[model samples]
Target: MNGYRFDKLKLLVADDNQHMRKLISTIMKAFGTTSVYEAESGEAAWQSLKKIGIDIVIVDWQMAGMTGLDFVRKIRNAPDSPNPFLPVIMLTGYTHIDHVRLARDAGANEFLAKPVTVKALMAKITSVIENPRPFVRTKTYFGPCRRRRNDMSYKGPERRAAPDAIDVDGIRPVGSGKTGSHGP
Candidate 1:
Protein backbone atom coordinates (compact mmCIF):
# COMPACT_ATOMS: atom_id res chain seq x y z
CA MET A 1 0.00 0.00 0.00
CA ASN A 2 1.23 3.46 -0.80
CA GLY A 3 1.72 6.05 1.92
CA TYR A 4 -1.01 8.63 1.39
CA ARG A 5 -1.68 11.62 3.62
CA PHE A 6 -5.38 10.98 4.08
CA ASP A 7 -5.34 13.48 6.93
CA LYS A 8 -4.73 16.23 4.43
CA LEU A 9 -7.64 15.29 2.17
CA LYS A 10 -11.14 16.70 2.57
CA LEU A 11 -13.79 14.04 1.98
CA LEU A 12 -17.58 14.20 1.90
CA VAL A 13 -19.89 11.37 2.89
CA ALA A 14 -23.49 11.59 1.63
CA ASP A 15 -26.09 9.13 2.85
CA ASP A 16 -29.64 9.37 4.14
CA ASN A 17 -29.17 6.85 6.91
CA GLN A 18 -27.70 8.39 10.02
CA HIS A 19 -25.96 5.18 11.01
CA MET A 20 -24.44 4.75 7.57
CA ARG A 21 -23.14 8.29 7.63
CA LYS A 22 -21.56 7.75 11.03
CA LEU A 23 -20.06 4.45 9.93
CA ILE A 24 -18.50 5.96 6.84
CA SER A 25 -17.26 8.96 8.83
CA THR A 26 -15.72 6.65 11.39
CA ILE A 27 -14.01 4.57 8.75
CA MET A 28 -12.66 7.63 6.96
CA LYS A 29 -11.43 9.07 10.24
CA ALA A 30 -9.66 5.79 10.94
CA PHE A 31 -8.00 6.15 7.54
CA GLY A 32 -6.55 9.47 8.75
CA THR A 33 -8.99 11.80 7.06
CA THR A 34 -9.21 14.87 9.26
CA SER A 35 -11.73 16.90 7.31
CA VAL A 36 -14.72 14.70 6.63
CA TYR A 37 -18.13 16.22 5.85
CA GLU A 38 -21.42 14.39 6.09
CA ALA A 39 -24.65 15.02 4.19
CA GLU A 40 -28.05 13.49 4.74
CA SER A 41 -29.20 13.67 1.12
CA GLY A 42 -28.09 14.57 -2.35
CA GLU A 43 -29.38 18.12 -2.05
CA ALA A 44 -27.44 18.56 1.16
CA ALA A 45 -24.43 17.08 -0.49
CA TRP A 46 -24.67 19.57 -3.31
CA GLN A 47 -24.97 22.42 -0.86
CA SER A 48 -21.96 21.21 1.05
CA LEU A 49 -20.04 20.79 -2.19
CA LYS A 50 -20.73 24.37 -3.12
CA LYS A 51 -19.48 25.56 0.25
CA ILE A 52 -16.59 23.17 0.94
CA GLY A 53 -13.52 22.34 -1.04
CA ILE A 54 -13.83 18.62 -0.98
CA ASP A 55 -11.26 16.31 -2.52
CA ILE A 56 -13.50 13.27 -2.78
CA VAL A 57 -17.18 12.33 -2.32
CA ILE A 58 -18.63 9.04 -1.13
CA VAL A 59 -22.41 8.98 -1.77
CA ASP A 60 -25.07 6.36 -1.33
CA TRP A 61 -27.12 5.28 -4.33
CA GLN A 62 -30.54 5.79 -2.76
CA MET A 63 -31.14 9.01 -0.92
CA ALA A 64 -34.31 10.77 0.24
CA GLY A 65 -34.61 13.51 -2.36
CA MET A 66 -31.95 12.90 -5.04
CA THR A 67 -30.26 9.61 -5.80
CA GLY A 68 -26.54 9.19 -6.12
CA LEU A 69 -26.79 8.59 -9.86
CA ASP A 70 -28.71 11.83 -10.29
CA PHE A 71 -26.20 13.68 -8.15
CA VAL A 72 -23.36 12.35 -10.26
CA ARG A 73 -25.06 13.38 -13.48
CA LYS A 74 -25.68 16.86 -12.17
CA ILE A 75 -22.11 17.17 -11.03
CA ARG A 76 -20.81 16.07 -14.39
CA ASN A 77 -23.19 17.99 -16.64
CA ALA A 78 -24.53 20.91 -14.65
CA PRO A 79 -23.18 24.18 -15.96
CA ASP A 80 -23.42 25.81 -12.54
CA SER A 81 -21.62 23.01 -10.74
CA PRO A 82 -18.83 24.22 -8.48
CA ASN A 83 -16.34 21.55 -9.53
CA PRO A 84 -17.31 19.36 -12.44
CA PHE A 85 -14.00 17.50 -12.21
CA LEU A 86 -14.66 16.35 -8.66
CA PRO A 87 -14.08 12.62 -8.04
CA VAL A 88 -17.11 10.66 -6.77
CA ILE A 89 -17.25 7.19 -5.27
CA MET A 90 -20.76 5.68 -5.27
CA LEU A 91 -21.78 3.35 -2.43
CA THR A 92 -24.87 1.17 -2.75
CA GLY A 93 -26.28 -2.28 -2.18
CA TYR A 94 -27.08 -2.68 -5.86
CA THR A 95 -24.23 -4.84 -7.07
CA HIS A 96 -25.86 -6.27 -10.16
CA ILE A 97 -24.13 -5.92 -13.51
CA ASP A 98 -26.78 -3.55 -14.81
CA HIS A 99 -26.54 -1.40 -11.68
CA VAL A 100 -22.79 -1.19 -12.03
CA ARG A 101 -23.10 -0.23 -15.68
CA LEU A 102 -25.74 2.37 -14.80
CA ALA A 103 -23.46 3.94 -12.18
CA ARG A 104 -20.56 4.01 -14.63
CA ASP A 105 -22.72 5.56 -17.31
CA ALA A 106 -23.97 8.12 -14.80
CA GLY A 107 -20.36 9.34 -14.33
CA ALA A 108 -19.31 7.80 -11.03
CA ASN A 109 -15.53 7.64 -10.71
CA GLU A 110 -15.80 4.49 -8.60
CA PHE A 111 -18.50 2.15 -7.25
CA LEU A 112 -18.67 0.41 -3.87
CA ALA A 113 -21.42 -1.94 -2.81
CA LYS A 114 -23.10 -1.50 0.58
CA PRO A 115 -21.93 -3.29 3.70
CA VAL A 116 -18.52 -1.98 2.79
CA THR A 117 -15.38 -3.13 4.54
CA VAL A 118 -12.36 -1.11 5.57
CA LYS A 119 -10.08 -2.87 3.12
CA ALA A 120 -12.39 -2.32 0.16
CA LEU A 121 -12.99 1.30 1.09
CA MET A 122 -9.30 1.98 1.50
CA ALA A 123 -8.50 0.34 -1.81
CA LYS A 124 -11.03 2.49 -3.61
CA ILE A 125 -9.70 5.62 -1.94
CA THR A 126 -6.15 4.75 -2.88
CA SER A 127 -7.12 3.92 -6.45
CA VAL A 128 -8.82 7.29 -6.82
CA ILE A 129 -5.86 9.13 -5.27
CA GLU A 130 -3.15 7.30 -7.22
CA ASN A 131 -4.63 6.20 -10.57
CA PRO A 132 -7.24 8.78 -11.40
CA ARG A 133 -8.92 8.35 -14.77
CA PRO A 134 -8.90 11.05 -17.41
CA PHE A 135 -12.08 13.07 -17.91
CA VAL A 136 -14.01 12.75 -21.17
CA ARG A 137 -16.34 15.45 -22.53
CA THR A 138 -19.09 14.62 -24.99
CA LYS A 139 -22.54 16.01 -25.73
CA THR A 140 -24.29 13.61 -23.37
CA TYR A 141 -21.43 12.65 -21.06
CA PHE A 142 -18.91 14.69 -19.17
CA GLY A 143 -16.98 12.69 -16.60
CA PRO A 144 -14.20 10.18 -16.20
CA CYS A 145 -13.43 7.97 -19.18
CA ARG A 146 -15.76 4.99 -19.04
CA ARG A 147 -13.20 2.56 -20.32
CA ARG A 148 -11.07 1.35 -17.43
CA ARG A 149 -8.31 -0.31 -19.47
CA ASN A 150 -7.59 -1.21 -23.05
CA ASP A 151 -8.01 -4.87 -23.94
CA MET A 152 -5.61 -5.38 -26.83
CA SER A 153 -6.07 -9.13 -26.80
CA TYR A 154 -9.71 -8.95 -27.78
CA LYS A 155 -10.51 -9.88 -31.41
CA GLY A 156 -13.87 -8.14 -31.62
CA PRO A 157 -14.52 -5.43 -34.19
CA GLU A 158 -13.63 -1.89 -33.14
CA ARG A 159 -16.72 0.11 -32.26
CA ARG A 160 -15.26 3.53 -32.94
CA ALA A 161 -13.74 2.56 -36.29
CA ALA A 162 -17.17 2.49 -37.91
CA PRO A 163 -18.77 5.55 -39.47
CA ASP A 164 -21.39 5.61 -36.71
CA ALA A 165 -19.04 7.03 -34.12
CA ILE A 166 -21.05 9.55 -32.08
CA ASP A 167 -20.03 13.11 -32.77
CA VAL A 168 -20.64 16.16 -30.62
CA ASP A 169 -24.12 16.61 -32.11
CA GLY A 170 -25.35 13.06 -31.47
CA ILE A 171 -25.13 12.28 -35.20
CA ARG A 172 -22.38 10.51 -37.09
CA PRO A 173 -19.14 12.30 -37.87
CA VAL A 174 -19.14 14.57 -40.92
CA GLY A 175 -16.78 12.48 -43.04
CA SER A 176 -18.72 9.32 -42.19
CA GLY A 177 -21.84 10.40 -44.08
CA LYS A 178 -21.15 7.97 -46.95
CA THR A 179 -22.59 4.53 -46.23
CA GLY A 180 -20.52 1.42 -46.87
CA SER A 181 -21.22 -0.80 -49.87
CA HIS A 182 -22.56 -3.45 -47.46
CA GLY A 183 -25.78 -1.60 -46.62
CA PRO A 184 -27.25 1.63 -45.30
Candidate 2:
Protein backbone atom coordinates (compact mmCIF):
# COMPACT_ATOMS: atom_id res chain seq x y z
CA MET A 1 0.00 0.00 0.00
CA ASN A 2 2.76 2.43 0.90
CA GLY A 3 4.86 1.36 -2.04
CA TYR A 4 2.26 2.26 -4.68
CA ARG A 5 0.84 5.71 -5.25
CA PHE A 6 -2.59 5.88 -6.83
CA ASP A 7 -2.93 9.60 -6.34
CA LYS A 8 -2.30 10.28 -9.99
CA LEU A 9 -4.49 7.49 -11.33
CA LYS A 10 -7.97 8.16 -12.69
CA LEU A 11 -10.03 4.97 -12.35
CA LEU A 12 -13.49 3.93 -13.49
CA VAL A 13 -15.59 1.45 -11.50
CA ALA A 14 -18.35 -0.06 -13.63
CA ASP A 15 -20.89 -2.28 -11.87
CA ASP A 16 -24.62 -2.74 -12.08
CA ASN A 17 -24.97 -2.81 -8.32
CA GLN A 18 -24.77 0.62 -6.77
CA HIS A 19 -23.46 -0.77 -3.48
CA MET A 20 -20.65 -2.63 -5.15
CA ARG A 21 -19.75 0.48 -7.07
CA LYS A 22 -19.69 2.49 -3.87
CA LEU A 23 -17.59 -0.08 -2.08
CA ILE A 24 -15.00 -0.18 -4.82
CA SER A 25 -14.98 3.59 -5.07
CA THR A 26 -14.38 3.86 -1.33
CA ILE A 27 -11.45 1.51 -1.59
CA MET A 28 -10.04 3.52 -4.44
CA LYS A 29 -10.35 6.67 -2.36
CA ALA A 30 -8.46 5.03 0.46
CA PHE A 31 -5.69 4.29 -2.02
CA GLY A 32 -5.46 8.05 -2.64
CA THR A 33 -7.21 7.90 -5.99
CA THR A 34 -9.08 11.19 -6.20
CA SER A 35 -10.64 10.82 -9.62
CA VAL A 36 -12.59 7.59 -9.32
CA TYR A 37 -15.70 7.58 -11.47
CA GLU A 38 -18.63 5.20 -11.22
CA ALA A 39 -20.92 3.74 -13.89
CA GLU A 40 -24.02 1.69 -13.21
CA SER A 41 -23.95 -0.11 -16.52
CA GLY A 42 -21.48 -1.20 -19.15
CA GLU A 43 -22.98 1.10 -21.79
CA ALA A 44 -22.57 4.04 -19.44
CA ALA A 45 -19.06 2.94 -18.71
CA TRP A 46 -18.24 2.79 -22.40
CA GLN A 47 -19.61 6.29 -22.79
CA SER A 48 -17.52 7.44 -19.85
CA LEU A 49 -14.41 5.88 -21.27
CA LYS A 50 -14.79 7.91 -24.45
CA LYS A 51 -15.19 11.10 -22.45
CA ILE A 52 -12.86 10.56 -19.47
CA GLY A 53 -9.13 10.25 -19.56
CA ILE A 54 -9.22 7.12 -17.45
CA ASP A 55 -6.01 5.37 -16.52
CA ILE A 56 -7.63 2.11 -15.46
CA VAL A 57 -11.03 0.42 -15.47
CA ILE A 58 -12.41 -1.87 -12.75
CA VAL A 59 -15.53 -3.60 -14.03
CA ASP A 60 -17.89 -6.27 -12.76
CA TRP A 61 -18.63 -9.36 -14.83
CA GLN A 62 -22.42 -9.17 -14.55
CA MET A 63 -23.82 -5.91 -15.79
CA ALA A 64 -27.18 -4.99 -17.25
CA GLY A 65 -26.58 -3.22 -20.54
CA MET A 66 -23.32 -4.93 -21.40
CA THR A 67 -21.49 -7.70 -19.62
CA GLY A 68 -17.99 -7.07 -18.35
CA LEU A 69 -16.68 -9.48 -20.98
CA ASP A 70 -18.42 -7.49 -23.69
CA PHE A 71 -17.07 -4.22 -22.29
CA VAL A 72 -13.53 -5.55 -22.26
CA ARG A 73 -13.88 -6.91 -25.78
CA LYS A 74 -15.12 -3.57 -27.02
CA ILE A 75 -12.29 -1.75 -25.29
CA ARG A 76 -9.70 -3.93 -26.94
CA ASN A 77 -11.32 -4.47 -30.35
CA ALA A 78 -13.51 -1.43 -30.90
CA PRO A 79 -12.50 0.40 -34.08
CA ASP A 80 -12.88 3.85 -32.56
CA SER A 81 -11.94 3.09 -28.97
CA PRO A 82 -10.53 6.02 -27.03
CA ASN A 83 -7.61 4.00 -25.67
CA PRO A 84 -7.09 0.39 -26.55
CA PHE A 85 -4.11 0.15 -24.24
CA LEU A 86 -6.02 1.19 -21.17
CA PRO A 87 -5.51 -1.22 -18.28
CA VAL A 88 -8.62 -3.20 -17.27
CA ILE A 89 -9.18 -5.24 -14.11
CA MET A 90 -12.21 -7.52 -13.96
CA LEU A 91 -13.70 -7.70 -10.46
CA THR A 92 -16.30 -10.39 -10.11
CA GLY A 93 -17.38 -13.36 -8.02
CA TYR A 94 -16.58 -15.69 -10.87
CA THR A 95 -13.33 -17.15 -9.56
CA HIS A 96 -13.39 -20.20 -11.76
CA ILE A 97 -10.47 -20.77 -14.08
CA ASP A 98 -12.79 -20.73 -17.08
CA HIS A 99 -14.08 -17.33 -16.08
CA VAL A 100 -10.57 -16.02 -15.62
CA ARG A 101 -9.60 -17.29 -19.03
CA LEU A 102 -12.68 -15.69 -20.50
CA ALA A 103 -11.72 -12.35 -18.99
CA ARG A 104 -8.16 -12.71 -20.23
CA ASP A 105 -9.32 -13.58 -23.72
CA ALA A 106 -11.70 -10.64 -23.62
CA GLY A 107 -8.75 -8.29 -22.93
CA ALA A 108 -8.94 -7.56 -19.23
CA ASN A 109 -5.47 -6.88 -17.94
CA GLU A 110 -6.18 -8.59 -14.60
CA PHE A 111 -8.98 -10.44 -12.79
CA LEU A 112 -10.04 -9.97 -9.18
CA ALA A 113 -12.63 -12.05 -7.35
CA LYS A 114 -15.57 -10.61 -5.47
CA PRO A 115 -15.76 -10.11 -1.69
CA VAL A 116 -13.11 -7.54 -2.45
CA THR A 117 -10.75 -6.22 0.14
CA VAL A 118 -8.48 -3.23 0.38
CA LYS A 119 -5.33 -5.32 0.34
CA ALA A 120 -6.45 -7.37 -2.65
CA LEU A 121 -7.64 -4.33 -4.54
CA MET A 122 -4.41 -2.47 -3.84
CA ALA A 123 -2.35 -5.43 -4.96
CA LYS A 124 -4.25 -5.73 -8.22
CA ILE A 125 -3.95 -2.01 -8.89
CA THR A 126 -0.24 -2.04 -8.17
CA SER A 127 0.29 -5.09 -10.34
CA VAL A 128 -1.38 -3.28 -13.24
CA ILE A 129 0.63 -0.15 -12.53
CA GLU A 130 4.01 -1.82 -12.09
CA ASN A 131 3.67 -4.51 -14.76
CA PRO A 132 1.92 -3.56 -17.95
CA ARG A 133 1.55 -6.35 -20.52
CA PRO A 134 2.49 -5.70 -24.13
CA PHE A 135 -0.41 -5.68 -26.54
CA VAL A 136 -0.65 -8.43 -29.16
CA ARG A 137 -2.47 -8.03 -32.49
CA THR A 138 -3.09 -11.43 -34.00
CA LYS A 139 -5.87 -12.25 -36.49
CA THR A 140 -8.30 -13.22 -33.72
CA TYR A 141 -6.85 -11.41 -30.71
CA PHE A 142 -6.04 -7.75 -30.10
CA GLY A 143 -5.09 -7.27 -26.47
CA PRO A 144 -2.42 -7.97 -23.88
CA CYS A 145 -0.09 -10.90 -24.38
CA ARG A 146 -1.83 -13.83 -22.69
CA ARG A 147 1.30 -15.73 -21.77
CA ARG A 148 2.74 -14.57 -18.46
CA ARG A 149 6.14 -16.21 -18.80
CA ASN A 150 8.71 -16.67 -21.54
CA ASP A 151 10.88 -19.49 -20.28
CA MET A 152 13.81 -19.53 -22.65
CA SER A 153 15.47 -22.52 -20.98
CA TYR A 154 12.55 -24.87 -21.55
CA LYS A 155 13.20 -27.23 -24.46
CA GLY A 156 9.84 -28.41 -25.70
CA PRO A 157 8.28 -29.64 -28.92
CA GLU A 158 6.22 -26.50 -29.19
CA ARG A 159 9.13 -24.09 -28.83
CA ARG A 160 8.80 -21.31 -31.34
CA ALA A 161 11.65 -20.95 -33.80
CA ALA A 162 12.52 -18.05 -36.05
CA PRO A 163 10.24 -17.57 -39.02
CA ASP A 164 12.95 -18.63 -41.44
CA ALA A 165 14.27 -21.43 -39.25
CA ILE A 166 13.15 -25.03 -39.09
CA ASP A 167 11.53 -26.29 -35.90
CA VAL A 168 12.73 -29.24 -33.81
CA ASP A 169 9.74 -31.14 -35.07
CA GLY A 170 11.11 -31.02 -38.65
CA ILE A 171 8.28 -28.74 -39.74
CA ARG A 172 9.72 -26.00 -41.93
CA PRO A 173 7.53 -23.03 -42.69
CA VAL A 174 7.50 -22.22 -46.36
CA GLY A 175 9.69 -19.16 -46.90
CA SER A 176 9.01 -16.45 -49.51
CA GLY A 177 6.24 -18.66 -50.97
CA LYS A 178 8.84 -21.06 -52.36
CA THR A 179 7.30 -24.52 -52.34
CA GLY A 180 9.80 -27.24 -51.42
CA SER A 181 9.88 -30.82 -50.14
CA HIS A 182 10.42 -31.43 -46.36
CA GLY A 183 13.30 -33.84 -47.16
CA PRO A 184 16.71 -32.88 -45.82
* Backbone collisions counted per model: 0, 0
Error at 159, model 2, angstroms: 8.0
Clashing pairs in 2: none
TM-score on alpha carbons, each prediction: 0.81, 0.80
Writing each residue's lDDT as its tens digit, candidate 1 over 1-184 gives: 5668888999999999999999989999998898999999999999999999999999999997799999999998888898998999999998665566577778888888878899889878877887677676655667876655533354543334344422211222346543221111
State the number of backbone clashes in model 1: 0
Residues 1-184 of candidate 2 have per-residue lDDT tens digits of 2555678889999999999999999888987889999999999999999999999999999987799999999999899899999999998898655566577778888888889988888778877877776666666778876544433454444323334322211223446343211111
Top lDDT prediction, candidate number: 1
Cα lDDT, all candidates: 0.78, 0.77
Q: Residue pairs in steric clash, candidate 1? A: none
